[model samples]
Target chain A: MTITLNNRIETFSPQEMSITQIMDEKSFHFKMLIVKLNGTLIPRESWPLTVVRDGDRLDIIHLVSGG
Target chain B: MTIIQNITSHLSVKKAGIAGAGGLGSNVAAALVRSGVGHLVIADYDIVTKPNLNRQFFFADQEGQSKVDALRENLLHINPKADVEAHFCKITALNAGSLFGSCDVVIEAFDCADEKKWFAEWMIAHYPAKPLIMGSGIAGYGSPETLRVQRSGNLYICGDQRETNEKLVPLLAPRVIMVAMMQADLALELLLQEKPL
Candidate 1:
């Protein structure tokens, strides 16, 4: 499946995946993230349940730590 | 409901809320005030310490002073006319509304990763229409180019987006101020309705 992730085209297998699964695949371990699926905000508890399909726009904005 | 005015005049009527006063909050406050933000409502419960002197805007003699009190004084030094509301308390979801609800923009500069995560979710949920600029990774002295800002809707997260918590990487002045200044610049841009830098 192909979708726009962070404004870039990303292709992966299985055609569909949850937010948690996609983040894991992308190695996005940042704790503070703004997860948006096609412009709708997704809460943390919903990550495992929110699924995205081909052509979906999933934006996971990472808030870096250290300060 | 809008008035046509110069940028400086516009900033003089705008307000910003900062949730931390250690490094990012302190420095961001300074930058904002210097840039002509009229009022700043800063809330933080920490006290200045010797270690904090490495990056925070506080001085060595102000080590024992409360972070909010010290920061308010320092911010005033930069812009005497700037109105500052300093709160010596930790910002939680319950108090965040009271603290930052009325401000034009809000800044999240907490020290811990856990707090940042929780606050990010909280701010996005509670203040969807308000601009919330948050810092994530402002540690270490090298890799200044690694720092960047990520925007999603009204939430702006600035930093390297990958550094370990400051407790692990050790926060330094240059990079810390870099992120803080960037966050402050974003606040200005947001307040002026300019494109995010």
Candidate 2:
């Protein structure tokens, strides 16, 4: 399984895992999220820790202050 | 609207330590005293100058007075029963801990962001139970409505979204005083076990 981490997700695993499972056991501190899969932006809470398939392009977006 | 009948009830119980006895600090100390805050520990290494009088509530007669002493005098005048402890030294990392040790809440009314960050982190790390209220971004003469509140755990932050614009609106006395009152009010609510203001 190939996985990628972007933004502040370097500590998160990209392997096959559910987002719910990852958040339930690992980090509950994060209050913002928008995961991307293969150039498609996933919903704010849909990113799972499941195994990442090939050709997946991940982009993690968080809130920023000021323009 | 819980109107505290005995204003001195909780005011006499907890002490509030105020850092940066300049414009924001002066306003904070005065408001705390007026609100009957029990004990207030104030620290400021600056002196009153002509320009500081434009916004700061100190008297024109106190031009050369130490900011800490002037603040103490003014606070006592407003509330004589309150204990106003003034430290003429600056609130550096060396002295921040001791100064804020007994304070139930620490107000970082510092103009400089770096200094405020240092005090906030130090207070949170050393006094995890005591809350740290910080000021930020209240720069221009824009909407006081723009002043928002941000809190993560025990650290609370207020002020503008960006730095002040010296030409357009450079945080005047009215706005700074308004925001300072908000900070003081929030601190009192937290200390007195009342709902957030």
Candidate 3:
């Protein structure tokens, strides 16, 4: 399955995965993250339960410090 | 037509809420006030110190003063008629909405990744209709050309997008204020675009 992650399309073998699994697989280990799946925000508490299907568009933003 | 008259006529009735009164917050608040934003709600629990003088808006004389108080004083000095509300407390998911609910736009000027994430998420979740201006990665001696503004829905993020480790590079005034001014300009632009209810 192919999906756009941060505007870059990538293929995944599993075809489906939880948001948490996707983050872990992609090494998005940053403590500060804003995850949006197809324009809907996935709360931190819901990452594990939320599943990302094929063709989904994910926007993963990292906000850092210094002002 | 005088600049002050034009600014007052355009912005005398708008209100802005700044989440942190540090380098970005103080400078953003000052620019908004000078532009004649009618009211401001500024929050911060930290105190000014000698090191803050390098980039923050507080003067050396303001050392040891609470950031919210010092920032309010400085803003008032700029526009005495400006209604400045200072809150000396840490903003969390619970109180962020209530504290800034009445504001037309919210500015995120936090000093930590966790705080920025929390505030952005909370605002996006609870206040979906409001505009949120945030900053990230304004540290060291980065070139001005690297800075850029990106927007997604109601969220506008302005910064170099390069994470500068504070330990490795000190936060300087030029980059910090440049991003702050970007946030301020975006806030004003959003405010101007809104049609009165």
Candidate 4:
């Protein structure tokens, strides 16, 4: 199967490539994911249900610890 | 302009919530309350230590008080009619939603970029309808006029951006107050629907 990461759709294994899957892959230990797919920000509660598709324009804005 | 008049006319109306109650947070709360924003829900789990006196606008009498309590007292002094709800706890994923749920907008006043990111991400994710306003990059004690506002749709970050490597004043007073005032202005504009530039 193939799915897009960011704006460039790339081929990937059959593993799910949705927001939840990407966070899991990124090993995002944070409690939330700030993702905007096609200009629509996916709610934190909805990230688990949001299914990433082919050519999905995604912007994953995460938190960092910098003063 | 007329926005100020409108605020006074609608004195019964509550504007929004503020996440931090430290340097920037306390100023924002004071401005809003003075402008008759009606209601404020301020959260901060820190206390006012001697080290905070240089930048934080605390009187000599408030030295040993909790940050939330001190700030609330200052705000009430500005507008005795204002309703203030103070929470003496650090804002985190667990309480951000419940604490910020009722307000139309939320301010991320923490200067630490990491804490801003955490609060911004949580607010955008959990409460997409509510706008998140924050400050950043005001390091190195720069000019007060350098402050500006940038917006990406509903998210707005207002502050001065300085190089990360620069060594700034150990405790810059002017720049901190400048950025804090700019943030308060932006917050009021958002609340009042004033003509924004």
Candidate 5:
């Protein structure tokens, strides 16, 4: 399956994967993250259950410190 | 109309709400007031510290003073006629909409990604009609060429879009102020859209 992560296309072995698997694969270990699937916000608690299919656009934004 | 009159007429009546009165917030607020923004609502719970003098709009004498108080005073000095409301408290999702509800525009100048995301989500959910200006990835003494403006619906974000933490690259005066000024300019542009003929 192919998916768009942060505007870049990537190929995945599985046809579909949970949001948690995607985050784990990408190593997005940041605590302060904003995850959106197809422009819809996916709450942190739902990441394990949320599924990402082919052609999905995932936006994982991290927050940094410094005013 | 004279240049002064034109500027005053266009901006003197617009209200701006700024979240986070640190480097970005304080600088943005000062620029808006100097540009003739009529009213400003600024919030921040922090007090001025020794390190803040490096880039913030503060003086040595302001050390230990509340950020909002010092910022309000400085803004008033720039435009004595401007109305400034200082909230010496941390802004959260619960109080953000109420605090800046009536302002023409809300500028998100938070330092933490969590806070920024919370406020951004809150604004989108509650005040969808209002425009929000935000900054991210503004760190180090990098080139100004990296900075750019991006738009998504009513959300206008200005920065390099590269998340550089303070550990890797320290936040200097030049880069921080550059993004702050970009945010201020974008706020002004949005305010001017509501100007009366």
Candidate 6:
């Protein structure tokens, strides 16, 4: 499945992806983050339960730390 | 010519939180207060020491005074209308949520090299909806042009995002305050966007 991630095209194997799985796959490990799915804010607790499908929009805004 | 527009949202920022009351924290508090954030909650365990005068917002007379207290006084001096809360203890991952839970936005202003990421993690994990603005590379004072703010979702990072911490190169006032001001500016933007007037 291909979806929009950070304004870019991304493809996952199962045609669907959980927020946590995508974060792991993309190595978005910055501790400070803001995750949104299809324009709705996704609480941290919902990352695991929130799944994305084909063509869905997911934005993972995280503070890139060089500390 | 129009110098600016719609900047009247200062009061709309409502409450902001600063986790550390040092250079970045204190200056951020000052900027937010002057800019009109309704309430500010600041936390820090350290006191105003001589070396801190190089960049922090404390005074010589404030030496031996706790940073949280001194900063509160200084902010109030700038804007008597400023609503400030001072915490006289260290902010750890454990107490971060309670200290800043009511804040509309949280500024990660710790001066330590090691605690930045951990504290950011704790705040975001506990309050996912609250915007967290962090200062990453604010140490030293030469590259002024490198300072910038990057935003994603509810997280904003301001600074060169490359320089080492204070231990390696002293925290000069100019660069630190510049980054602190940038963080405060971004906070204003986030708050306005959060509670559109």
Which of the two candidates, 3 or 5, achieves a greater TM-score against the reference? 3
Model 1 chain A: lowest-lDDT 10 consecutive positions: A58-67
* DockQ of each model vs. true complex: 0.64, 0.05, 0.55, 0.14, 0.37, 0.15
Runs with alpha carbons beyond 4 Å of true place in candidate 2: A1-67, B1-3, B165-169, B194-197
lDDT tens per residue, model 5, A1-67: 8998876788889999999999899888876666778867788999999999999888776655667
Q: How well is candidate 5 docked (DockQ)?
A: 0.37
10 residues in a row with least lDDT, candidate 2 chain B? B160-169
Error of 2 at B191 (Å): 1.4
Q: Write the per-residue lDDT of candidate 1 for residues B1-197, one digit (tens) a residue.
A: 22433666778989899988888999999988887889899999989989999988999989899999998888888878889999999888779889998999999898877788788778777887998898977778787888888777788888877756445678889999999999999998899886222
Whole-model lDDT, candidate 6?
0.78
Tens-place lDDT per residue, model 2, A1-67, is 3444442223444545554554454444344333445434455445653434534434433221110
Look at candidate 5 and tell me the lDDT of residue B7.
75
What share of the reference contacts survives in each candidate? 0.69, 0.00, 0.66, 0.19, 0.47, 0.12
Interface RMSD of each: 1.9, 10.3, 1.6, 5.6, 2.6, 5.0
Q: Which ten residues in a row have the lowest lDDT in candidate 1 chain B?
A: B1-10
lDDT score for residue B137 of model 2: 59
Query: Judged by lDDT relative to the true structure, which candidate is superior, 1 or 5?
Result: 5
Ranking by DockQ: 1, 3, 5, 6, 4, 2
1 or 3, greater by TM-score:
1
Give the top-scoring candidate (TM-score).
Answer: 1
Residue pairs with colliding backbones in model 3 are: none
What is the TM-score of candidate 6?
Answer: 0.72
Would you list the clashing residue pairs of candidate 5?
A63-B113
Better model by DockQ, 2 or 3? 3
DockQ (C-alpha) of model 2?
A: 0.05
Kindly indicate the candidate among 1 and 5 with the higher DockQ: 1
Place model 5 in a CAPRI quality band.
acceptable
Task: List ranges where model 4 is wrong by over 4 Å.
Answer: A1-67, B1-3, B163-169, B194-197
Which residue runs of candidate 1 sit more than 4 Å off their true CA positions? A30-32, B1-5, B165-168, B194-197
Question: lDDT by residue for model 3 over B118-163, one digit each (tens)?
Answer: 8888888898888999998799875799887867677788887666
